[model samples]
Target chain A: MSTADNPIAVLVELRDGAVARPTLEALTLARSLGTPVAVWLGTEPDADAVAQLGEFGAAEVRVAAIGAEARYPAKAGAAIAAATEDASLLLVVSTFLNKEIVTRLAVTTGAGVVVDAAGVEFVDGEVEAFQTVFAATWNVRTRIAGKAIVGVRPNTTTASAAEAPGAASIVPISVQLPATRETVTAVEPVAQIEGVPLAEAPVVVSGGRGTGGDYALVTELAELLGGAVGASRDATDEGWISHEHMVGQTGTTVTPALYVACGISGAVHHRGGMQASGTIVAINMDPDAPIFEICDFGVVGSLFDVLPQAIEAVKAHRGA
Target chain B: MRILVTVKFTPDLQSQRSFTDGTVTRTADDGSMNELDENAVEAALQLVEAAGEGEVYALTVGGADAVAAVRKALQLGANHAIHVNDDAVAGSDVFGTAAVLAAAIRKVHDENPLDLVITGMAALDGLTSMLPTALAAELDWSQLTLASSLEVGDGNATIVRHLPDAHETVTAPLPAVVSVTDELNKPRYPNFKLIMAARKAEVMQWSLADLGVDAASVGAGASRTTVVDASPRPPRAHQQIVTDTGNGGNALAAFLIEKGLA
Candidate 1:
């Protein structure tokens, strides 16, 4: 609902590898209110993002060439301005680097932003975004009129799961690169946890430290559910599970439809990341475990005692 | 380097929260500077140590409560803390906040030719994590995101970006904005000495008027995005209870069968 008369050009920021799921989701949501125009910030994009962006609903993929080292904020802001010249709303992926990109874009474009959205709807002719805040304690539904931007978590939207051939054309940004004030030395890769990332998965089965280094139950349960596996930071820190699967404040925030927390202590930080789940089920020996307090379904028992049955039920439900 | 490190006072990642209809509510018990921001501070501190001749400046925009956040940044090795306090700055969409921060950056640049602007890739409040990018554009600075490793030599910085299963090393000439991901380094905890040092130092506060901005442009009023409603995601359901007779193997089998898994 931008005040200016123009269709929104969803300014998707797509990177080489890690940016796909978010870009796809952004494209899916963009189809609702505007024509998605994906913006790849770098030299020519990888060959894959082309058709993928278009298939996800991007009508055009805009490219902005900046120094290879320029962080997302500069190029992305330039991309938003570049894309918004003929457009209204700009949709960008919510990431640490792109944050300033969107914020700066808003200032230059005189737009607004709805960020880290879980579910978004075009309600009553305006963009109404469902956001998870306060560790998922509150689900805020918001809307914006006039020109605006939306910063979305990766994998929040469900794409058609198909790729279409896309054409990526370079759009040169007039703005020159800013004099950088920070110096980067290097980047080391963290050991990635196994399974699909929480933000990208439809189903997830998680375990707390209660597993006592025995993830057999959680793994079996996740397999039965046909879902990815996740864990509490306690499990990861305890070496019972890896940080890759840890779901907490320092870890990944998940907005899945179904989230199963097993033997978790349910620290608030952990909940902050998982509270946006549609259906949360917790299984712990102590009913008082914090995880159960926020769960949509709480089972007061050892996970060792319950997951088998739940897996069975799920298998039956799936007719597997 | 004359670096500027920006940090945000954020609600404790562990704090339980609920929102009123269409409005998100938070308590005064907000927690630490987001862990990632702490890393930014650490990066700034480390850079200062490496540069040997530069001062570190911590910049922030928030109410009085955020004084703690700026102070923490000071404790991490920042020489000075600057608070941009303006009611107009509240509810600033990333763009508005960036505008004010841009003003602050311009102010800092005007005062002491800045060589670098550093920030966490994103704060725990978990918004669109796009602020760094915007700031870089506004300042027209070279930028780096998700820098995993960093080295400064001969007035140039060589940093590595952590991509999936691999890394990309890139070099940036001096005076750049870098939005560092948490992977860059673990932020060190502030010792008691630094904590007291932070207390002794004055944190300079500036208002919208100080930043030379109009009040109407910031916060929810000028924001294109508005909270329409807020509701706690419904409470979890009472789960079905299941127990075992100390024989996990046998019990597990029976349990699965009862649920029709077997």
Candidate 2:
């Protein structure tokens, strides 16, 4: 199939009846490759969804329209397969749910999946996916022989408004259903400290073992800056914080605009998760902490002593 | 009841890892069973021990070094081990790996129907977390992934998924695949007796032909994806260090203010 006939498809994910920020970035990335087609799963998007898709340059919006049966993996796979039959490429935000769909799609389509890709480009008529693997230590270029399905890392690109929005026409597509194998019976929201989503937070304030199991200073600083709170594996393992807040190779990988690491020793495991941050600042009492080596600015001091003053300074700056 | 647990032998995470020509530079003797898979082995062992009437089979696919993974599983108390070793299976991606595993599971089910298939959340090397779902799709079975807690009874499996923002309880009928996270259970250490037994126990080996998989459709040539290029990551840039005397915090805050990050 010619590339022109098969447009690049972006799997659109909606939350609270609007396009999620990551989905917008995925749309932006899809438009870079070729004509962008947004694939809406489960329900027909409302007018607002269509406007947002067009703002990101979606020329067409294909709705799979599966009813709410919680057939997350199976239905998602069938929908993506039906939508991207002749598409040049398919893009999805790499979340736990979408990763499963990507795998299933690979099996059903005899295709290959590149997970957690930072970027995608068409090189010499073949799609190349740039992946940062092994704790962000290596940048590998991967290629798929057939139409490629890629799971892009969130926040890899900033979403930009298009000058000439595409005329998006919603087209309903039929899919061959796979047998329902799993269903989400119940969901309980996590009790959060309440700030921006950690993955999308502009600033992240993290504490580690050097905090002496005291997160009071870290939380105060984070809240003062209107940022998210993060913890190291040691802090989480020691019960100082929940696993959900841990930032490391085995935990959540974050790339915020500013990452302020307090009391963290800069272990390789932790570095693997946050090395991609736009700017790094380290605060550690130990002058020889490894984190200082990678920080854009480093402070050799106790977090307990430094955080309070930093919070006050930030407050004063804002007030002034 | 019959159970199958899947394990992968990957390079130790602490070891200096690299890729050669787009493939992992797997060092011999440095590779062992993936740490997360140990949880699956432990979970399987506990389930079989509790029931007292079921057998757990450990399965893995790779070259010669992969036998070490099965041996580790056997040491952890799996009744038998099956190693799918074929030269043609080298460089197979997740889909290819899942295809082989599904075929092997089906071959075993034909002999004695399986009640459950379990795996870890992901392989540390690839970190794709794709095998269980792909296997489910291939076998047309239910998949319950990232379960922090699990229970099996009355022809059904129930799991509690510890998601980032929420906790979800999911249930699926038996003859399903489940992937467990590290928080599920603490893995037990192999006793000396089991260690000795693992060395003496015979490991069954199967080839692509034995599993009825076409080599061309799975191995390097059949691989849907290729590594076009790879290189070592460049070193991080030099950093600016600040010694916090009394004004350190204010200085750091001033920097954030300058960058509009405060």
Q: Chain A TM-score per candidate?
A: 0.82, 0.89
For residues B151-257, what per-residue lDDT tens digits would candidate 1 score against the true structure? 77677666777544346566777677777876678788778898888889999988878777778877767667677787765655544443334433344434434
Worst 10 residues of 1 chain B by lDDT: B240-249
Q: Write the per-residue lDDT of candidate 1 for residues A5-123, one digit (tens) a residue.
A: 33546555543343557667777877767556666666666656676666666666666666554454444565557646776566766654455566666656667677777666666
Top candidate, metric lDDT: 2
Pairs that collide, model 2: none
Model 1 reproduces what portion of true contacts?
A: 0.48
Residue B24, candidate 2: Cα error in Å is 0.7
| A120: Cα error in model 1, Å | 3.3
lDDT (CA) per prediction: 0.68, 0.85
Minimal lDDT window, size 10, model 1 chain A: A1-10
- The number of the candidate with the highest DockQ is 2
